[model samples]
Target: MNLLKIENIQYSYGKNTPFEKEVLKNISLEVNANDFIGVIGHTGSGKSTLIKICNGLLKPDKGQIFYKGENIWKKGFDLKHLRFKVGVSFQYPEHQLFCETVKKDIAYGLVNKGVPEEEQESKIRQVLKIVGLQESYLEKSPFKLSGGEMRKVALAGTMVLEPEVLILDEPTAGLDPKTTKQVYESLKEYQAKTSSSIIVVSHSMEDISEYATRLIALDDGNILLRGTPAQVFSNTERLNDMSLDVPITTSILSMLAQKNPSVNTNIYRYNDTKAEIIRLLKDVKSIE
Candidate 1:
């Protein structure tokens, strides 16, 4: 069964007002098992609104959101349970942090669900490690940590539940390059182990292209393109027209192809780009 599905969803910011503005129009999406979906769009493209609707945090003006074939908005559908199953961490998760310590913050959800104290402690430690934090830091105030550290804590809080579908919005917004990579690696590893689906909204073409199995590009509240990273990035002209740039690796490969006919310009991943370059170097050595 599809993990989550959005069917012809429409949303507006205001109703019957002069300032009313529609943010989404007939948006449809299907998330399957073990799917890693990347959503990209400029400001006001409704990416945030769409994700919020997926977890029952926001109601759509039209259409329905389904989790495991059940309409999320249907009466007595257990919205609380749906939220627990489909975890969502917003762009600035630190805003939601209110506990005195990181451990308490991460344990809040467990407490609500009435999980055993011992299991909560174990899950807290496990998720902390996944987020690359030391156990010693658990007692420290989340408010005292750096921006990147706080973000990690927030991520751990959501991940501790081991939700079937994880949604993150700019999860790496405040992190350095190394930290960003570590966060993505942790998420990738978590998904691999649990077969859970992930939906990430990011502006970084490089990171998204490398990690996401599929890509969705939104423009003016509508889906402009959707496909594998290579397939979507292949439409350089269309993306450029939409003010979106392809991954740096893809652009570099395209440049290499222009100079060398044998170069494969379809590469969108950094590792693949490096491998292609190494193969070319070996070919040159053999020729010489």
Candidate 2:
């Protein structure tokens, strides 16, 4: 089933003023169950705007957004209810954390929804585990934690609600390599366990290539490419023309293909590319 659909939606900033500018133009996208979608583009490519529209944070200037076949902007449609079904964790989400303790921060949304206190505690524990945080840290101040831990807390806050679709913008921004890996691992586990969809906006070609089941490449508020990571990254010239880059592994494979036609340049995943190179070396040894 299509979990969310954006149909020919257009958005602009300063709509009627002298500085009016359209950020998204006739953009259409559909998210499905258990989808791990990556939205990639350079700055001002409307990646953030599109996700905001999905979360109901911003209204489109033209067109409609549908959640499970229901028009979200139609009269009597509850935007607040839509948010509970589709959660968003914007860039630098850690900065929004304000509760005195990690437990309180993660429970804020549940409290607002008037969930039972016992149920809130259970949900908090479940999400904390999902985000890779220990129960001991739950009693500590969220602000005192390491940067990565704080981000996970923010993520846990959103995950406690178990939204059908999770949207994140620059989820791993400013994190170290190990932390970045951990964050994605947690997200992958969460998606697998809940069978929920995820839409991530990231600048790291490498990260998105490694995890996303599908890729959407946006340029100048338009979708320039959309496909599996391999299919989209194969268009190296098109992405390069827009000042975007393919994954580092993809670039390496492309270079190898240029030097040796026998090299398989179709791979984009880091592990798969590594395995392919190993296989090629084994073939050379056998020939020798």
Best by TM-score: 2
Q: What C-alpha lDDT do the candidate models reach, one value each?
A: 0.92, 0.92
CA shift of 39, model 1, Å = 0.5
lDDT tens per residue, model 1, 1-288:
999999999999878899899999889999997999999988888899998999998899999899999999989899998888999999989889999999999999988878899889989998988889999989999999988889899999999998999999999886899989989998998798789999999999999999999999998889989999989999999899788999999898889888889998889899999999999899989999
Residue 49 shift from truth in candidate 1, angstroms: 0.5
- TM agreement with the true structure for every prediction: 0.96, 0.98
Task: Find the 10 residues in a row with the least total lDDT in model 1.
Answer: 185-194
Which residue pairs clash in candidate 1? none
Q: Provide the lDDT at 158 for model 2.
A: 89
- As a TM-score, model 1 comes out at 0.96
For candidate 2, what's the RMSD?
A: 0.8
